[model samples]
Target: MSSALEVGDIFRRHGPAYVHAHDGHLGRVERRVMSAIELCRTAALGGHIEGCQACGTVRVAYNSCRNRHCPKCQGAAARDWLEARAGDLLPVPYFHVVFTLPAEIASIAFQNKTIVYAILFRTAAETLRLVAADPKHLGAGIGLIAVLHSWGQTLSYHPHLHCIVPGGGPSSDGTRWIACRPNFFLPFRVLSRLFRRLFLQALRTAFEAGQLQFFGDIAERADPQAFARLLTSAGRQDWVVYAKPPFGGPEQVLAYLSRYTHRVAIANSRLVSIADGKVTFRWRDYRHGRRPRAMTLEVGEFIRRFLLHTVPDGFHRIRHYGFLANGQRAARLAACRVMLAAQVPKAEGRAEPMAKVAPTPRPCPCCGRPMVTIAIWYHGQAPPGGPFWNDST
Candidate 1:
């Protein structure tokens, strides 16, 4: 019925649209985020670009866009991010818990953004902590990390959190560490019910506190009665609470976390066909066999979908709580690492494995010594046709 869309057409139209729309409003905070995305790995960002002096193998000095949202820049970020976390991992089987918001709540989230999203994180974390503390499960305090992913494989807004936690936690007295059974984790049904109730309760609180702003299709819910109705409907629905089996060990958990943290909506290589102003890309249909599937959308529609993931200003998508709290974390982590290492057998000789760093390409226009990093370039300040993230004034 309508004309098809090409990937190129979509890119040509909306590729720079975000750049323009994001102007000045990004301000100081957003500029820092954009700088990490644009300046990463470009000569304009300035780096010690390596080049062979004799063979004329040249490399251009570059920087990296450290933006968590940039597809091209996330690999290195994940690697480095994992490295920092590796030291804190315990020598035990860790579980992966996924908490997903219902479609109705997701719709509301799209309208309110900052307020709803923050509540989503807090409520979910609270649910996990409360349920895990119950004597029926493992009556211990679990330390975990939660990362919020707001996009599905097709760049659609699907807000969810990926939580990696030790199967067991330390007891209330802090004397003996409790461990969950190797095979089974918490019951999903119980977790889901508790999660639903807690989330709704928190949502109602936010509404009364005037933290949530209703607009557009969601304006009807401004009335407390309407909002209560929406919550009731959502609460009855099966809120997704998926728990993955325990990982092999600490390294396995950290490796898995690397994939979810600092990821963009989609990778460039996954982009396949762009035809007639429509764009097609690969996606994994999780409802099925996790099979690879292709989806097509119009150029304008695609951009609209993509832009939905731009987070509210200064809101943290990745958060640590419980034992992972920022205050006294370093000291607590060091103590935990020491306690765990005492149980495991000592290493034979070599050091722990290192996460891989991305290879930075050097393009030497002037075949001389490796250019040293002098400065960095952010998005707005980038000169026309210059490095996207270079720090050229």
Candidate 2:
């Protein structure tokens, strides 16, 4: 793992050149993301020292950039987030549903990210709620944990929502729990049609209100008639909404969330090589029987593809709706636990009973005992009064 290829390596080597070549074209957020990834986990951020007591083996570990887009920083963040969500898990099975934007809308989204992305979230959640609440459907208010992913396997601009929804929800009258069919949650055609209608309607409204902007090849869409034609074309095509079978249980749900919630466009393990001014990485071709394949791109083009995924600053990609909404989560969860006759987990920040299982400690490198932090080293500072003062040491 220590010698593995990483996105940071590619960035550290050629990111400056990439930035210099496309200086004015890069957005502020994209530039920041590049800088953060290039400098992450190096002396730029500083880190701490860990020592094993028995063997007295000391090692220096650099601080992570903690930028959300940095692949290296997402592991710990994902673990911490999963810990907090562990208590929020219900006993029921969970379903994985996906809502994808049409290619025409995706082009518009590239320019109007904040507005269009927010609309994607709102409209997707609304579609689920509306469909589930009707008598012809589940007739229950569903809860969803929606995560926004804006890139495909090959790092293309493909905006979609991956929703983890419970298999059941509270009855409209709040008297009992309402469950969907054992195998099926909701009809996919129904979800797709409603989602298409809601999303297109909201998009048109945003265009009419002068909230969307078009540029480059899509600049012609700035005209009201052209934009209307785009929407009409999208409405006529079938939008895709996919529903997978429910997960085995809550544990499986957590496993799924841990992977999807904090993932970047690519991970270090996927990188195959970088040489001759080209970067190579592995990607799965889902349309072609999920065959694994390698792709190579010029250094500048690789950076350009990466920058395309830089989300708007301060925009949240993960959101909860219905019972999981922040305002009413606690009360609603309590009600849900009571209705299901399941035990409510203890509140967060409280020490668990000793009888419960505790997390395993990180093993030491030399002697296999638990490693402990002895000191911290900040950027631009040397070790305090030590002969081992070299930056590389």
Candidate 3:
């Protein structure tokens, strides 16, 4: 078998194939991302070098690719995000909820990404909040962080939102923290039905405003009747709303949140091989027993699969609503901690100390010792001033 491919290597070898195959409007986004990834952290964006005092190693640390879709760039971001969110974790149990749209809607999303995605986030959150607020159910106004992922394990247009919701919410009067029963939360059937209705209604509004486009097999959605029929069919079909078992406590909740937030369509570790110039990787086929298997594709096809997931410009995939809304999170979290602490003997869950966030080192390929950052330029932003073309020094 040939060696496995890191993201950089795949970009170098097969990126052109992706760019060439994608020759239309959507293709432009893919091309831009590819260029950004290739030059990110390089002299192209302008960066400086650093030397390790101990090892006598000199390396050039370029600026990060920074494209949210880039695999190499999201790690440090995920960590920093979790840090600011540290105090938000309460001692209460938390649940992981996922709501997925069918392929029928996914086609519309492909054309109207930012609009449909925003609607998806809105409808999904509303469904959860509405269901949980009912006295017959959880009967509380919950806090949840929702992240939208637009691709399936195989890089298909399978838009879904992943949510980490606290098991309880504050009382309607905001006087005390209300907690859900230990073993149960909202009713999934109710959540699915409501989510389906809200999404279709929002989609219809988007269509009437002429905000949606149609081409290929899905082009007919531009027709009002066709759009209504599509929604009606989807209404009959099950809109999947799955909730994982309750976590042990808030610590487990943050650990879970750290996974979904800031993640792209796929991960580097999942790539297994680039043998004979063919890219091979693993994916979970959720339809058939959720079985795990490997897929091998020629370099061109491989990149096409990867490029299919490049999101629309300025789209915010991670969202917060209800009490977890950004403007109100701090006060709400503080209240949650205080309320939980009063009820449970140990309400302030012991959060794991955050690991240090350090600048990435570019080590010598000759010897894997860490390279140092001798100087920073933005003065604080990133490497500045592209390197000299010819410098032996």
TM-score for each model: 0.80, 0.91, 0.86
Q: Candidate 2: lDDT over CA atoms?
A: 0.86
Error of 1 at 347 (Å): 5.3
Model 3: worst 10 consecutive residues (lDDT sum): 384-393
* Candidate 2 lDDT, 224-305, residue by residue in tens: 9998898889989999999877897777888798899999988888888999999999999999999999899998888888
Cα lDDT of model 1 by residue, 236-314, tens digit: 7999999887787776776688778887777667777666767778899988989999898876566667667777777
Candidate 1's C-alpha runs over 4 A off are 1-13, 16-51, 334-343, 346-393
Model 2 misses residue 300 by how many Å? 1.3
Off by over 4 Å in 2: 1-3, 52-56, 343-364, 368-374, 380-385, 388-393
Q: For residues 106-199, what per-residue lDDT tens digits would candidate 3 score against the true structure?
A: 8778777889889988998999899888878867889788988877787766888898887899878877777887778888999999998999
- Return the lDDT, model 2, position 349: 25
- Return the candidate ranking by lDDT, descending: 2, 3, 1
- Can you list the residue pairs that collide in candidate 3? 41-62, 41-63, 47-383
Better of 1 and 3 by lDDT: 3
Q: What lDDT is obtained when candidate 3 is compared to the true structure?
A: 0.77
Q: How far does residue 170 in candidate 1 sit from its true spot (Å)?
A: 1.0
